[model samples]
Target chain A: MARQPLRKVGSTWKPPGKPAGQAQAQDPAGSKGEAALVAGLRAGDAKAFEEVVLRYGPRLLIVGRRILGNEEDARDCVQETFLATHRSIGEFQGRSNLGTWLRRIVTNAALMKLRARRTRPEESIEEFLPKYDPNLFRGGPRNANALTPEELLQRADTRKLVQEAIDRIPGSYRTVLLLRDFEGYSTQETAQLLDTTDGAIKVRLHRARTAMKELLAPLFDEELR
Target chain B: MREFLLKLLLQFRGDKDPGPTEQRVGSWMLRHLPGMLTCPEFEEFIHDYYEGLLSAKVRRRFETHMQLCPMCQVHFDSYVRAIALGRQVCSDDEQLPEGMPQELVAAILLARNQDLDS
Candidate 1:
């Protein structure tokens, strides 16, 4: 198979020595798999419950982290998610993938905790992207008036700018963006985890990236100007 | 290109197992060089829109903004590719548990085979 290129934007794709250890697409558990697990749990098969728990544990942790914001709270959220999952197995009805169902339970648990603590929504959607003003940096692409090495170094400092911008974003936008963008959750999965619609996930993601860009305006000023 | 870099940095900031959020975001942005050459407006929308968080109206506005912005479209594409690559990296590194949960597997099998009458 032709290796996928890790091309930079505006550049044609080129094959780099393939980097290793990529995660696979998340496959929802089949009905048969769910049925088996449900049967085992219903039959008081302790081992079966353990299997389900093990399979879904890390994902549960990731979802919990987004909502709870700390590993300790996230761990508690995972436990609660499983406990609820076990209690509700008989009633699962196989309507959704087991992982989706579990994620729903975990998200609800974390949201409830967030609500109880009155965790404030951190940044508005517009504020999530990094900030830059185009009028200030209106030089055309061919202009080479400002390429001194030291000044160029400042323009190169993109990572720092991007980081600071993310730091400024509201926690709600951060969570959704991280889950969808960083953690590789599908819009549907994110919606399930966030208890929102897929349309909502797309909007949050778009806004979050835009806000991040705004936050990093200084980084762009040197390069674009 | 500028938008693409931001999207990559935004979504995959932590996946490199970067020690901190700051480090992750910084490292990712630095890695994608020269792409920032283009001045992109979608970048502004990305950061500004997020400050408002999750109001229903903001969601609508964000969508509307994307529909109108060409730069954001390119950024969105890069963001998606970066995500796919990150997942690939994570998947290859993960170590599966030694065996399938035997009890869980058995339970699922039993459930599938079970007849209410039996």
Candidate 2:
């Protein structure tokens, strides 16, 4: 059967108009196209391989950069991901979309790089949590309404500050945060990728969030002032 | 309200009047208020609270606690900001510094072809 070309959807591979609840009802044509592409990749068709690279390279690079925190390392990880994918194409079950499978590969590659590059001891997140007084409240009651995160996020500088704060979190907690929160991976997926339990992912996510908030509290406080 | 009395007492104690920012921060601290949840209790339920997984009774309790607790409110706000930052950084619209590098493609294809030949 002649295969249709995979539609170049948006920058990411999300179905354009389908709501998230309809994820189980994938577009038949799109699925057929991806199945054909997978077959071609398995057969070592050069065109199919090139198409995958061109389509997914930028997106994977962004994932690498965010997790690895630098262009050089990110590029290396993306390249490694492609190489790994090419070698392991036969093992890819059709359970997930090709893009999602590739994302998982890229995440793994980036996380490996991150682990190798880490030399510092992990830091405790306790200091980042809010300290309570005898009354169990840090600050007394008042009438000022701090801006919502959505409001602060509208400012480009605030976005940059938030990004910087994310970067400062220790790698152990940071990776869990990135995979679960940033990459939108489920706790189960993140746990599998990181080789931990879902319970651990939940704990780390909470601590990571608390630490992140601590890092940004000063900036938010400044904005409120 | 008890909070109003506390503010009055601070003034009588010859403490400088609380600044607008301090007052604002203080307003969130509902610890002395009835139905207030302690910080530890808030932390225990916060994730479930955010995810909307808590039962209605628990959710109501959590909301009541947030209403009375300034510190938990701040904690929740910061938690939200952290998630937002991650989303923004990882957003698909984030442009690569330089478009995809040609050398990367060339290298991958070369490596793959070499593997094929072998």
Candidate 3:
């Protein structure tokens, strides 16, 4: 007997539950819309490509700005991100959320830009970290008093100060701090994004947090008094 | 005799005490402080402690040490504040800068369309 070719059950393949285009049209940035967006991109649908850029372009630029710290470089990074995503859309396995995948791409692009621009010798993080005595007791200025109501009222300014302090840290630690603390990426995710070990991520995160505290100590101590 | 009189007058005026010079670690805390973990050791575990990754035994010891060591406590508090501030700054979506550049969008679309054609 001659063998007969078997036909697949469904003519059209879609992600489990709900058509992607409809869901995405209702809420473009939501995860439900991601499948349809991915499908459209895979199919080379011009409208899908336009929608992806229109929806995520501004947010991705913000991410790039945070990492690169310059408007022009950030813009360049985001541009590269969209182009790279377009070229590599076929390789996107949908293992992570679309936003996360895009974020990882932008982070890598910004880091590359930063690396290319690092012509001078980088400064040591020690200067920004807290000093400890021989016994390992922190020896910097102390503030035993908690934040008062008046001090708490300056939270907005404090946030800006914190962002400034973050910008001052060395790029290596700064990236880790931004990804882990600012972006709320898990240690594992940050490590994967940076192509480093989990242990390295944890160590850098600890040092970065400690350095940030040291940098902000003067401001906080003044408020305490 | 003059010094004694001044001290007595200050006491009577309720100004002799310098007030509490910040909260010192109580004697009870000192008695319970971990003898094994030094400041450096405790410092190394701070990240794990904050992330809730420390084992129960280590966490107990770290907490005990924190109770007795005002310096470490202050460091820990500052670390917490730093994390909180970072989160606060990051979460304030209002601080997001202006929208994406128009030219960049056009460039991306052009590149993507060219790729599709090829």
Candidate 4:
């Protein structure tokens, strides 16, 4: 009669709060009740659709905004992601966590929106990349006075600066950085998604990171003096 | 390669305690190893090394360069630190997306309903 504490629904683990009496941990489908949920989804149960939207919407919205870079586009992307998921659930095999699957859908939807919204040529990332020197240590490779992740949480200005810097990086390179670093894709996966070579992806990722470092230079400055 | 570079580092940087004999050997490697990386070359490989994408031969060369060149060490360490910081910023950024607005959810459900009817 013990209630399970947590369940992995799609890609994320959350407490099985609303769907009472589900036993977790032993079930590989992540949630003991997930099969029924999937069944309802397949059957076009309106409530099933609502439950999933409530569960994964926020995370997916983040993915949307991060990639699409605006409120209106992000909201539109989330809607399309759910509609796409609903249409494609029968084909999803349930091999991966539903959350993981949904995240991918959201990411793709955002990227497609991004491609459509390429109104002007991408801005140059040269100013954002590190200032390399041909001679020696790029001004003696300054000290790593880096902030801790917890420290980053307390620093709103740094976070805002980072957001601004990301907006500055060119689309091609920024997409690579987000996929490889934040979205946790491998170089190969990123290359495949972007239709490029692994070497190309690696180079772009490096440039992206270096550009980010340059942009956030105020926080983590090089030892130029 | 590693031993050779460590010797070279000890000699050029005058690391104080290198024995008389080791100093001679480091001096020898410095002259013999024509293919050793220059500082500029090391700069190119810093990010590659961080990503763990360098080949074994290249990695040995990369490590040797880092050890031998104090400036490059500072440079590489700085770059690596910035990368770690970038990841942290990203982790925090991920928090920005959680707690999706309820209107969006209702909108999704409503859209799904319309799709079903159509």
TM-score of each: 0.48, 0.76, 0.76, 0.77
Off by over 4 Å in 2: A1-33, A139-150, A222-225, B1-36, B92-98
Q: List ranges where model 1 is wrong by over 4 Å.
A: A1-35, A124-168, A182-201, A212-225, B1-118
Give the Å shift of residue A12 in candidate 1. Answer: 7.6
TM-score of chain B of 2: 0.63
Worst 10 residues of 1 chain A by lDDT: A136-145
Candidate 2 CAPRI assessment class: acceptable
Q: Which digits, one per residue and each the tens of the lDDT, describe model 2 over residues B1-118? A: 6446445634543334344454454445454556556767778776666565678777666665554444565566556656665565556344444467899889888888888789
Per-candidate count of clashing residue pairs (backbone under 3 Å): 64, 10, 0, 6
**DockQ values per model:** 0.06, 0.24, 0.22, 0.24
lDDT of 3 at B35: 47
lDDT of 2 by residue, A83-113 (tens): 8889999999988887777777888888888
lDDT for each residue of candidate 4 in B5-100, tens digit (9 for 90 to 100): 665555554533334465355434533667667666776786667766678789877666554443455455445545556566666555453576
Each candidate's B-chain TM-score, in sequence, is: 0.35, 0.63, 0.65, 0.64
Model 3: which docking level applies? incorrect
Off by over 4 Å in 3: A1-28, A134-136, A148-156, A222-225, B1-36, B94-98, B116-118
True interface contacts retained by model 1: 0.06
Better of 2 and 4 by TM-score: 4
On lDDT, the leading prediction is 3
Candidate that scores best on TM-score: 4
lDDT of each residue in B1-118, candidate 3, tens digit only: 4334333433443422112221232222334343446667788888888877788778766765654455676677767767676666665642466555788889888877777689
Per-residue lDDT over A1-225 for candidate 1, one digit per residue giving the tens place of the 0 to 100 score: 221112232233222222232112233356677678878978867777777877776666665665566777777777767766666677777566677667667777887787676656454465333333443222211111222223433444643444445546676676676666555566687787778998777777766655554453343333344
DockQ of 4: 0.24
Interface RMSD of each: 13.2, 14.8, 20.6, 14.3
